[model samples]
Target: MNTTPAFSRRSWLQRTASGFGALALHDLVQAAQTPLAVKAPRFPAKAKRVIFLFMSGGPSQPDLFDPKDYIKRMHGKTISAPINTNELRVGTDKFLALATHGEVKPRGQSGMMISDLLPHTATIADEISLLRAVHSDNNQHQPAALQFHTGVTADVRPSMGSWISYGLGAENSNLPNFITIHPDSDTRLYGASFLPAAHQGTKVVIPQGDKQSPIDYLADVSGDAKAQRARIDFTQRMNRRLLKGAEVDARMEGMIESMEIAFRMQSATPELVDISNESEATKKLYGIGEKTTDKNGRACLLARRLSEAGVRFVQVTMGGWDHHGNIRDALPKSCSETDQPCAALIKDLKSRGLLDDTLVVWSGEFGRTPWSQDLSGTSPIHKHGREHQPESFCTWMAGGGIKPGFTFGETDDFGFRPVSGKVHLHDLHATILHQLGLDHEKLTWRHLGRDFRLTDVYGNVVKEILA
Candidate 1:
C-alpha cells in the first residue's frame, strides 16, 4: 500500500468505468446462459410439435390431388378457364390445350381422391385431411415459397416455424426450438425477421450416411475439455463486460444463447443422427436401405426422433419438383423419393402415441396449370408442360386437431380454380397457429411502431377442418 501511487481524479474515473464495464459484462454472461424454458400457450394447444414437409417446387395439382374428368376428354383441345390475373402469365395466349396424367382413385376410408403416383401416401389417406382448394397470391417459386413459409410474398417476416417458436418457446432446454434439414439456400423460408434472433431456425445438412454427424460443427475441434471450458468462460465474461442496458442487448443475448446451445448440441445431435441402432425391420419400413427413398427416409426418421426429443418445429425440404418440361418423367421420380418415407413417418408417429399431439403438414408452394403452355399459337406445339397456377393447389394435414380422413374445399371441373371452400394462405397460417394454442390475431410482435402478426392482419381460422 505504501508503494502504491496516490489516486488522482483521472485514475479514480478510469477505475470506476472499468468496474461498470465488468458489471455490464456480468449481465451479458447471465443472459447467454439462460435456457429456453417451456412456456404455456395462449390456451390449451392440441399439438405439442409440428413437422412441416415442404416440397420445394410446385407439384402439379391437376395431375395429382385434384382430379378433373374433363381434362382427359379435352386433351389437346383448346379450353378457356378463369385464370387469376395475379398469378404468373405464361404468354399472351388466352386459351391453351388441356392435359392430365395419372389415375385418380378414392383412397382410404375418407374416399379422398389421390393420384396413383403416391401409392404409399394413399394408404394413409384416412389419417390425412386434404385441402384441395388451397390458393395463394403468387405463382413464381421464390415469391410463392416466401408466401407459404412467411405469409408474405415479398417482404422479410418471421416464418411460420419462427412464429411457433416465439409463441410457445422451446420444449427442450438443450435443443433448438426450430430445426430445418436440407433447407433452401433462400434464408427467407426460415429467417426470423423482426423477431428475436433466438427464434431463427437451425439448419442441418442432410446426413449422407451413418458415419457422419448430422451437424458438422457439433464436434469440438480442440481435444481439451478443460481448455474449452476455460475459453467459454472467458469469452462469456468478456461479452458480458461489453453489454450495457436495463435489459441485456438482444443480439448479445442471442449470441450467448447460441454458444451454450452449440456446446450442448456437441453431445446430443450425434446420437440423434446415428440410425445404426435402429432395427432392420424399422429401417425397412421406412425404405431407408432402398436407393430411391434413402435420403428422404433418413430425414423423416430424424424428424421423428427430434420431435420425440421435444423440438418445437422441424421442417424437411425435398427439392427438384420444377417440372415445367417432361413432367411425365419428373413427377413420378419425385413421388418415388418421398412416398414411402412420408407414409412411414406417419405410421411411426401413430405407433409411438405421438400422433395425437404432433401435427404433420405436407404441401407445395402452388400448383401447375391444367392447361398446357402452348408457346406457338400456329401449331399445337409446347403442349407437354403446364404453367404455374396460383389459383388452386392441395395441402394435407394429419394428427393434432385436424379432422382425420376428411377432404375440404373443391376446385372447378377443370381444376383451374377453387369454386367452393377456398382456403387462402393466411387462413392456413391461422389454422396452424390455432392448433398450437395461439391466437393468430393476438400473437404479434411490435416493430417499427407497428404490431405485426404472422397472419399480417388477414386470416380467419378454418374451423370446419378442426376435429
Candidate 2:
C-alpha cells in the first residue's frame, strides 16, 4: 500500500486535483451534466439574490427585539397573572433585561427599535422592516431549524432553498445557485430530500480555523495554466466515455457538467471571497481587518460579495445564539462578531443601489424564554442561561419590497406571546416568496403522489410586512 501521509480529508481534497475532497469535488464535477428545469415567478421579480443571517440558536424576543420592560413595571403588582390574554401564553416568574447594555434606540425615519448589540444594523434601520412577532411550532432545535427553513414542523419536505433553486435556475450557470458559509467551521445545515439532486447547496469551502478565507478551495494555482487545462480536458474525455453508456442516468450528466464548472469557479470565486480589494473604510465598516469582529464580520462581507457576483441565494450563519447558559458571555461575543458585518452588508447593498432588488433576512429558529432561567428579580445579575421559548421570536428583512424601519406585531407585557399581527414561520416563508414574485401556494412540485411546496399547506402572506 502507498505510505503517503494519508489524505486527511482537507489536505487531500483541497490540494491535489485527485484528493480527499472527492465528495465535494464530485458535486462540482457533476454540476454541468445535469438537465434541470426552471419555472418563472408569477409576477415581476424585485430581488435577484437572497442573503440569510441565520442565528443558529434563537434570540429572545422580549430581551432582544421586543421591549416589554414598560409592561413589566406597569403591572408590577400583577406580574404573576397571565401577561398576555391571547391564544398563546407563557408561565412567568420573570426578570427581563436587554442582552446588550446599551439603550434600545430607534433608527431611520421609520422609527425601528434595534438592540444595541447591532450597531451596524441600526444605521441601516431605514433599510429594514423588523418582524417582531415570529412564532414557530417546535421548541427544540433540530425540528425548529428544519421548520424555519422547510416550513414543515414535523413532516419531511424540500427546504425553501431547494425549491427556490428549482424554480429559479441559477443566474450564473458557472457558479452554484445556493452557497453557505460559516464562521465556526461547522457544516450541518444543508440537505435536499426529494428535489432534483442539483437543488442541494454546494459547499465550496468549510470553516476550519480562525476566520480563514471562505474562498480558498475555489482558488487555483496560476503557474500551470496550459497543463491544468490539458489535464481537465483529458479527464473530461474519460468522464464522457463513462457517460456514453449511462444516457438514462441523470447523476452522470450532472457530474460531467459540474467538473467543468468547478474548474471555471476555481478562478472566479477567489475574487469574490477576497475583501482586501475593498476600501479600508469599507473593510472597517464590515468589521474586516479588525481586531475584534473577525469571525462574524468575515461571513457578512462574503455574503455581499457573493450576492453581487450573481449567486441566487447565500446564507451566512453565526451560531451560539442558543443562550442556554453564559449568554452574557456567549451572546456578546457572537453579536459583536456579527453586528458590524450585518450592518455593513446592508449598507453596501444600499449604497450600490442593490438593496432595493435584494432581500436580506436576519433571524434565529426560536427564541429564549422571557424569564431568566438562572437569575431572579431580586438579584442584579447572574450567570448566563436561557431556556427555549418558541412562543415568540424576532426576524428582520431589508430590501426586495419589504417595509423599512417599521416594526410589525406585538407581544404581551412580559413579552411572551403574539397578541396582534402574529406571524408564524409559514407566514414568513409565504411573505418572502411573495416579495420575490412567486405565489407561495402556486410554487409546488409533485412528490409521493402529492403536490409539495416550501410552505407546506398552511401560510398566508403577511401583507402588512410588505413595503
Candidate 3:
C-alpha cells in the first residue's frame, strides 16, 4: 500500500546501530549454523572427555590425604580453632581435638601422604594431581554439591558438564555429549538451565540389585519398526505445526533436536550400557561380581564404556560420606564401596589407551573438621566423628593436562584450614575448562542481558597443576 518495499527488522537494526548490529547479526547467524556440530576449540585441547567421580557428603581430609602428626599429639585436648559460621554453634573459641583414624604413609615415587583407607587409590598415586587445599564457600551438602556442579549455590544454572557440552558439542552424534550415571536424586546436579536443553546431561540410573534394564522404555515394544517410524514422523509433523509461528525459540529447537537424539539413541544406548560383551577379566577388574562393589563397579564400567564411545562428559556419584558420628566404621565402608571400582576405572582407561585424552576428577563437597564433636574422652574406636569444615579439603585429577604424581596446595598442621595454594571451586572449574582448551573468560553465554560463564566472574586457572 505504501508503494515501497518494507524494510525488514534486521535491515532496520543494521541501518540504525552504526554497524554494531551487523556484528550481533553475524553472531546469531554463526550460532544458528553450528548449533551442536563438533568445532575446533579456541586453543589446542589436552583432554577430549572428562569422568567426574563425585563423592557426595563430606570426607575428612586429615584421615585421607592431608595427615597431621600434630593432631595426634593433642588428641584429647581442647584447642582453640576458628569457626567461621554460627550455623554449627560450636563456639569458635575452643573445640575438642581429634586425631587421624589410620596411618598416612607416602605413596608412589611422588611421596604423597595418602591414608591407608584408600590403598587402591594410593596404588595409582603417581597418576594423580592431588589438590590438598581445595576449599568451598558452602559447607552444607546440597549447596556445596550445587556449587561444585554450577558456579552458584542459590540459583539453578548450567552445570560444568553442561558448559563443556555447550562448548564442545557431541563427539558421537548417536550419544549425548554429557552423561550422568547413577547421579544423586537432585536433577539440578546435571541440569542445563539457561543454556540450550540439548546440552543437558542424559541421565542413566544404574539398577541397584539384580535388575538389568538401565533405561526403562528404551526400546520400542510395538514390534513394528515401520509403524514406529510412521508414528514418530506423525508426532514430529504435529510438533512442527505447533512451532510454526513461534519466535524462533532455541528451547523449542533444542526439544526437537532432543527428540531426534532420543530416536537415534534407541539403537545406540542399548549397546552402550550392555556389559555382556565385556570380558570376564574386565568384569573382575571392575569388581562387578562382588556384592560390596557391584553397584559402583557397574557405574564405573559404564562410564568407561561411554567415555570410550566418545561421550564428552560422564559423572559417577557415590553417596553416604556424611558421617557426623561413628566415623571409624562408616569411613571404611564408604572406602570399600568405592575404592576398588574407582581404581579399576583409571587402570582400565590407561590400559585401553584412553587415559591420555580422558581427564578424571575425584572430589567431595568439603572436608571434615580437625576436632571431634564431643569433648568426652571416649574409647579410641568409638570417638565421635568430626564436623564439616569448608575452609579446606582435597580433590584429585588424573590424565590429560594434569601433572602426574603431583601434590599441589597445603593445609595447616592440624588440617584446620588452608595454609597456601588454596584452590577455590571457581579456579578448579576454570582449570578444568583450560585443560580442555577452553578459556574460562571467553566461554560465556548471554543470558538475562548479561554474559554468564561457568566460573562466573571469578576463576584463576591453576597452572601449577598442569603437566
Best-performing candidate as measured by TM-score = 3
* Weakest lDDT window of 10 consecutive positions for candidate 1: 1-10
**Candidate closer to the true structure by TM-score (higher is better), 2 or 3:** 3
Using Cα atoms with residue i matched to residue i, what is each candidate's TM-score against the true structure?
Answer: 0.89, 0.80, 0.90
Q: Order of candidates by TM-score, top first?
A: 3, 1, 2
What is the C-alpha local distance difference test score of each model? 0.80, 0.68, 0.82
lDDT tens digits, residue span 5-70, model 2 = 233324422442232111234442333235333334567777767888888888755555676665
- Runs of candidate 1 exceeding 4 Å displacement: 1-35, 84-88, 91-94, 209-212, 246-248, 374-383
Q: Identify the runs in model 2 with alpha carbons over 4 angstroms from their true place.
A: 1-39, 70-102, 154-156, 183-188, 204-253, 375-381
lDDT of 2: 0.68
| Candidate 3: tens digits of C-alpha lDDT, residues 1-467 | 11111343344334423322212444444444334566556688899999999989988888888877777888877776665445553422246677888898999999988989998999999999999999889878899999999988878889999999877777898888899988888889999887777888888888655445576566677878788888888987777676555534557656777777777888898878888899999999989989989999999999999999999999999998987777888898998899999999999999999999999999998989888764343445355777787789999999977999999998887787788999999999999998888888878765564567898899999999999
Q: Name the weakest run of 10 consecutive residues (lDDT summed) in model 3.
A: 1-10
Candidate 3, residue 226: the lDDT equals 82
Angstrom error of the Cα, residue 187, model 3: value is 0.9
Q: Is candidate 1 or candidate 2 better by lDDT?
A: 1
